[model samples]
Target: MAFGDIVQGSLQDFVNIDRFDTELCVFIHIPKTAGSSLSTELDRMRPPYHNIHRKYFYGDTVTFSRIEDEIAAVIDSGALADARSCSGHFSWTLAAPIRAARPDARAFTFLRDPVKRVISDYRYSRTPTHPTYKETIERFPTIESYIEAPETQDKMARFLMPGDVRTPHEIDTFISTNYAFVGLLEMYPLSFNILSLLLGHDRMPSEHKRKTENTVDNAVDETPRLRAMIAECNQRDTVLYDIVRHKLLTVRDDWRAMREQSRPAA
Candidate 1:
């Protein structure tokens, strides 16, 4: 199944709250990356004066769905104090719709190591409710086999096209340009701390600070077949991972230096 199928019911009315005071923090949820848990924590930590609504998209359409209409209705109702803080699983295309709908909003997203992400996704897809799981696994002997399969490559290409099939650069550009913060799921604590500092919130709670259990039980190894498949299936993600990884390291180093400088004299 594609990403949009999971959401149920008319989320429109539910998301239309108006009272908002915090900076509009949009969590661009990539699939299977602890989004649900993190969003739950964010809900608890959200300021009383802010209106935060969590939503997930259903299809590729750019126009406002029933959900978007609900958001508009809420804003019109003046329930939010300052602005709306909306977070959910949406494609990069949703950026324009959001900006048009709420001009004062800022966007953020988190990404995982693509190989691990794909594995977790494969496990989650196996659920009976997932529309594409049976078809996907039926074609391959193992998750590794599936990764190496050309058809699997095509499937991933279509699902993660960023903007669409034609705009190959859309996703990267969106990350580099629009997002106020692009978090690394591997270094989640640092990412969360950075997010909190950037958004001017206090630290995230201890319960929310830990990583989620791996959805897949695949063992990590460097077998030749595994290596080859990971090398191929992860080429784009390798580039993305390196860039983001470097950025995280830089941020860490800078933070450490700042802390050292701020230390009281001996």
Candidate 2:
């Protein structure tokens, strides 16, 4: 719990004050993995522009036309505590552009079980206000038809590669290379602790440490076709999930033991 004198300033002064430094931390915010909550906490901890504007950028945009503009705006608006550190739900392709713009930036990301994530995404995609979900679903006779359709593939491709047109190999490469730290959502406290260490904080804010919402309960009755569609839709995520799970398992034995020790000595 000893956070050295790395940061020299009052916490209040740190918040909402823009100051750019040579070394920066880029939080790669993947959707639905407690991203919004974490971003809020980071915003409170850092300055306003320090948290990247996820809403402003169109997720479909392939070119980096607006990234430079946003960065410049952050610099001009004095909303960034450190111009080097930018956090948002951005594509991995932004790595080169970010580095070119700010060479000293380090990146981090959080991931979760792909099946659960996709189910949550589906639920969120459907809203009383937004008719896109209804329209998209209506276009297909069934979820299976939607999954097998070319449009689904196109959408998935675009989503997976937000800033660039990437092949499967390229996508994997981008993720592995760009991210400095990849925390698994299943290991909640450990993930937060790791992120805190990376951010040079003693502990994560208590407010940020809550259970996730929008989760799909296993009790929900899903048809075989629907299940198949869901699985197919999230196949790539499944691969990524397995990779992350394996990596975490490699280093989690000690953490597991510590957790067990902390439990009531029954």
RMSD over all Cα atoms, model 2: 9.2
Query: What's each prediction's TM-score?
Result: 0.63, 0.62
Q: Per-residue alpha-carbon lDDT of model 2 for 121-164, expressed as tens digits? A: 44544433223545544565443454566544323223334545
Candidate 1, residues 100-181, lDDT tens digits: the string is 6566666666667767776666666555445444555575547777677654442222333351433325544534455565
Pairs of residues clashing in candidate 1: 1-132, 18-79, 18-80, 19-79, 19-80, 19-81, 20-51, 20-80, 20-81, 20-82
After TM-score superposition, what is the CA distance of residue 164 in candidate 2 from its true location, in Å? 10
Indicate the worst ten consecutive residues by lDDT in candidate 2: 1-10
After aligning candidate 1 to the native by TM-score, how far in Å is the CA of 65 from where it should be? 10
Per-model RMSD to reference: 11.0, 9.2
Residue 40 displacement (Å), model 2: 2.0
lDDT of 2 at 60: 50
